[model samples]
Target: MRRLPIRPFAVLATVGTLVLTGCGTETGDPGDRPSSAGADRTIRAHKVMQLTQTHEETGMTLLEGPVFDEDGRLLVVDVTAPEGKPKVMRVNVSDKTFRAVRTQGQAAYTSAQFSPYDGRLYLTDFAHGEIVSLAPDGSDPRTFFSGEIDGARMNPDDLAFDRKGNLYVSDSRGLREGEARGRVVRIGRDGRTVTVLAKNLAAPNGISFDEDYQGLWFSELTENRVSYLRLDGEGRVTSSHTAIRVDGGIAQTDSIAVDANGNLYQGLHGRPAMAVFNRNGERLATVELRGRTEGLESATNVAITPGGTKAYMTVSGPGGGFLYTFDALAKGIRQSNGG
Candidate 1:
């Protein structure tokens, strides 16, 4: 693995919320849909291409959270590096070029993505129980959010964005870790925290909002299921539903992405595989990884381009790393039966 300098925020102590934003409240009416981020428009689909291996031709372990930037660079979290030296890798899509985005000792990033509001990359620091925000250029990486360091309750993993600019961060902790049950939280812009959503879930790892902006969808890893809930007025979770059910979440249910067409794509844990759920919560299709090795090892994260044609996923190889692109180059994206 490549080595890089690390930048970690030194922890002082837990700073209790000055004022909590969203907490458990009365379920509001279903009319609480906020204004769309932008005028409704169609998301054009593009030809999907597989990302080539950056290290050797094969055999580099996966880097977490493979997401794109405005400059066409794919940023991935390299977690399996030497202890006290986890880092982010930036891969240039144009020529399969790559570089370390940031470095961190004592903190391994589990998941990451670029904020639509700010270009900063928000990545989960596994060791610190906090979020790391990196400058758009990969400089000035520092602590972004955390409930408690080494605190059993908050096990932040995967995250997503809503039109309101708030974030949906899920805790993958199961019941055994009583402090942290599998739940979803809505983090406001001002860093105000609130458990606006959630309950007893399996491994609630990945989450996403529907195109209609009326519902929140998440993946339950252990249960091998994809669950969802409709939001009422005031951004409160109203009705909980299941979008798709699978016997096994092969990829640890790493990440998820939804298209304007109402189709949901999920990255599995170990297997280099991606699952699909239609709007009606129907199992539409599953895309497996190509090439040698054990089935696209780490389909860690999934990303849908602005156009929606290509579905980009990460085949995170810790022993060896590579980026796998699943574009609709030959076959077109199938229709879904989801709501």
Candidate 2:
């Protein structure tokens, strides 16, 4: 049940395809993008699954942080080269038409996620510092959370939603770049707030819930580790433990995601590609990746393609940001399906 991005208005009603982009790109194709000493075509790419040239930024980059709605439309909040309150745009996956999503938020948006349950969009304003929801028909905006919790600091950078409609936000807790104290707040319908479901954690960048709601998984950026906490009846932490620790020793792990089969995909902050971990916390795969060198170099956001097809990631750009798609199998990709 995917809805078109067009309202029943008199004009501008068009259809588009869903796309995923990332990487601070180099001015060449994947084959020309990067190569190791003996690396050649053996590092083949699967159909170049998808490509984005941010012409807006001199054809050297694609905006980072791409997400999708049900209609298969790709939405990304470009932090660089922002113009007049319009920072987010929808890129037609099948085609290459760009439409604006939000032009003004009074703050720079770090990341966002679409609510499939309601077709509403939620975004984090890292600069002005808040979480907001965009109107369904692309209308007004509303505030969900701000850096103020009971008059305390709660600046949010990332967001995640659970199966039952509970909202999870990754509150960096402070403004310092890599602060260790962070919290994941679950906002219940009753407006009640809950924490870490455990506490004294590291910089939890991305937060996700297991399909069964039995537990929650989150990753620490500076710590380069992912942890899982069994949730109690009220979504509080019952038992928490590390699911995967960056083996390369002290690499920064940014964004994280889980797939249909229950495997984890984690983006290493300083690595050339992303890493895969089994639900059992075993090392799985390292997704090969590279960009135009003109855009983003880091993959900070990750999503599982709808229908279990591809893996979507967002790499912030040199100026605009881009989204890149990967062939999970062809790339020797392993999903977080507990395998």
Candidate 3:
């Protein structure tokens, strides 16, 4: 998914300023703004499992899309794995064991989540621009959504489903092209109606419904900010605005999750950390890796348990692919499950 070179932290500071001023309408009053000077609390995450080790020829492992299943097992995808290798795996966090979930074809899977309606596992194939599904045990592979929509090719990065079983996806084309070619699409439970909810976004990567399901929160990677779209009863975008403007330094916003309290857990790329933000776009705390971050730099996606007891992040780089665990800030409901 990261086809572009990593930008320096200095460069990002300039970019962040431009994005904050030009992106969208800002919510919350200036007087209510929480100080961005630093996080109130800092939590250290420990490694729970290492999926891959450092390799020379094969390159650094890039892991993404950490989601929990109904049985409480963690599911993740390795976007850099070659063909014949296990692209998806089920990790039993209790014992630190894992099982490979067979996926057909050479698609580079980026995200995974179990549908609350059908109880099937769905994944976004970043390489093929397709959304595929399978059983919990990783059987019955089938394509759910694919190809172009309204003449635009999809570069699906992350996805989430609503309580009504409607699926939403972030088509991340802008990050690679450096333009506003990104889009957010919604598919009805019938699996036939595909609706384009929002367009002209700057590489929208992560997506999740708000606590009340009245709107959606998505991250724009190129813009270095997170935006929200107020939705109608029909799941159409009524209005939208920028919620959080992040100074990622060397990192860019990737996947995100919303807790029961409507707090957003925004994952970062090129930095081993997850930035927590409240509904008013205030910084709460930052969860970071405990030890050296020499090679493990990509902390792209995170998922919290149903009751918000624990949270896990998928990190990968030259060091290898690993899952890091920490405590959750709020109760993790359906909105924080996959995205």
Candidate 4:
């Protein structure tokens, strides 16, 4: 991920206060009643793999983009790891073991997903402003999308693919309030033509196609909200609107996934939780960490298995990075794989 600029002094002061005093409280708009507000069902997630060293000595590690390959192996990215450290890892959930898959580059890979057309793994290299792809075994890395569009650089954060193999990316460039320089772009299946589907967004980060692929959903980090874009037969946006507004407290929204039933599992920072919402924006439930949140404040991304019976979340903070699992609310499909 691109380094975030420091906020204004007043906003920093307020965020500091919230961090100190609201550690145990649930975060959401008071006007919106979350199911967690009334004995809502809570899924306890346990750690499956540890991805980092102690932050005091090695700095913080950020884990994002939990995805599963056709072989059922889980893959994730370590965005904060420097050169020579593992940037991509493969984990076997059955035995709770993991191994470094690729570590030869200096790329800050923020998200990973398998292409339906090629079956290769594609990653969003946020630090390089490009999308790179490699074979399932982590070999033959090559640039898939790079350079600029309309004379502007792109900070590609996350991506999703359609049934026809077309790719959509979220260009999370501007982080400042009221700076709507962010956008969403699409790459045709031919791998040459690039189109800007939406622009003037506020740090559009997580992106995924909704059920039936008739629309798209993306999270605007700067605005702390999710927006939906109805797409035409040619994947052009016909209409768009804000679907959900989140009260992030001291944090912001991050990566997201969609279930077969069209429920959105949105990851959150500054807390170990995920807020679930139906396609219509109704609060369904808030999936919270099962244990201590002392150093696990960052729950940035989630991936559900094919059957949707189980889900995994990638979390990180000063305590390092970890993978947590919980029961999913609905059946999982291709859309729930990753973003």
Candidate 5:
């Protein structure tokens, strides 16, 4: 068995709050229905293509968190590298060219997102417990936030920002399970206040906001289940429910992404498959990975392009890590970068 650089047993500590903004806007309403529930509910499999062999070329494995940049380049983290080493790579989706996006020697980079407000990328450093900000071209790297929040150590993993600029992060706590150590936090746009939306999660690995921006969804990796939470006017979680529970098939789930139509995609780590869920949390389809190298052994993360035509996913195994691109049945929600 192969081990990823980021341990699955770590946890984080902290909670915060801030004044809610734009509560009644399109991105603020939590009343959107979850599923369209018609022909859109089922998605057929599409063509999957392996883009590059960077991991094999550089001996860098354990890839995670892929987000498309404004230029349509995908930025992913190579978590196996050490501190002070360059760990993020920008890949050109068209020509299959890639290069390291230089950062100021931050710790291991895990997940990254394009911030619409600053026109910058926010990345999660697994070793430093901080969020590092840098330009889309990977310049002017700086620590956006670090250290304890609300008196607890903040180990941010996968993160996403709401339209209002509030950041939500999953503190995997080394991917510990069922200990209540794992937590989800919302950071205010002001960059000071924090709010604990959900805690005691069993390895909350992947998180995303609904298309309506009214609800938040996350997957408990070890629990083999996905969950949904509705937020109140104050950005506090008002209600929660189990979205989907994988009773069989993939054992562990990692990162996830959602499309504009509320279709959810989750990477089934240790398996060559990705599961799709409708807005109502029903299992809609299962897209099995088909690659030249015996399929994707470990699908770590999934991201859809802004136009929603292609869905990019990261996979790793003993052989190496590879980026798999395929035509998506549904259109993904555009990120802050505009893809």
Candidate 6:
């Protein structure tokens, strides 16, 4: 049964409708001020499908790491199920129909990305501290890398790849807040060598390249900040700094996606919303979700489609988790070279 909210909230901004801008405060909270992009045409995100529900025994129906598959289905990771089993499910966006992927072993898959270069799927296995690759049809799983760097454990949480086939991974090291054990590393195209790009991070969660591939952006959960790194030809961080910081409204900044015009869409773990920012780190808009999807507690991650017209977000709330689709005015940067 489709569990609907007690009361439904009206759409704040309809799709393709232009709005007027309002003055905003320094904190960037929606209540204090309106976003510049808010005046522009916006789309009120509607719930597309309920992907997972909370399990009675474990209460862990958390969903994360959503990616569009080759056949246009949405692939997501469900962390908790009956008997403490973790697995991945493929969902048909058009009909909201889904089924678990057939796989072996303890399912601790956290994230999945389709490699445009080699036509395979890359996934992060948090349980074994390894990265695995699989066939397009979810078969022939094999370990890509499962080792440490500088004697620290490689507790990878999220990954992003560049056009040259290099993969960047954020190692959380399972550290708590304020503990700076998190780091970001890169796997060479050869897939054998692991190089540390930066260290002493605070719960680094999402890793993504900018529109032109000249800069990299990542989110720090504990610090509530997003940092940008400029890279030279050799894939080395030439300079870096904090681009944006959340003060009061949103709690934990999770995954991030970049649009074609360099606007960033960030997911919040403590707040049921997605925050948008310009290239200079200015808050452009906040798409808040509540009473839109059943049991939605927080927005965990976001992904913008190729042309940037549509967006997909993963939410983990009270009863279970859901995947949502909406019309996005900002066009997302199309990943190049088969990302």
Query: Using alpha carbons, what is the TM-score of model 2?
Result: 0.74
Please give the RMSD to the true structure for each candidate, in Å.
Answer: 11.5, 10.2, 7.6, 6.4, 8.7, 9.6
- Candidate 4 lDDT over 50-133, as tens digits, reads 767632312456777788999888898877566677788998888888888888766767789999999889998776678889
Off by over 4 Å in 6: 1-43, 81-86, 248-250, 290-294, 334-339
- Collision pairs in model 4: none
**Residue 237 in model 6: shift from native, Å?**
1.2
Q: What global local distance difference test value does model 4 have? A: 0.74
Model 6, residue 46: distance off in Å is 1.1
lDDT of 6 by residue, 129-163 (tens): 78888887778887888777889657676788887
Error of 3 at 153 (Å): 1.6
lDDT, candidate 3, 174-244, per-residue tens: 55547788889998877789999889988888899999999999998878899999999889999999888
- How much is 101 displaced in model 3, in angstroms? 0.8
Query: Where does candidate 6 have its weakest 10-residue lDDT segment?
Result: 18-27
lDDT of each: 0.53, 0.52, 0.73, 0.74, 0.62, 0.63
| TM-score to native of every candidate shown | 0.73, 0.74, 0.87, 0.87, 0.80, 0.82
Off by over 4 Å in 1: 1-60, 83-86, 148-152, 175-180, 249-252, 317-319, 328-339
- Candidates 2 and 4 compared by lDDT, better number: 4
What ranges in model 5 sit over 4 Å off?
Answer: 1-60, 83-86, 103-106, 174-178, 248-250, 292-296, 335-339
lDDT at 20 for candidate 5?
Answer: 7
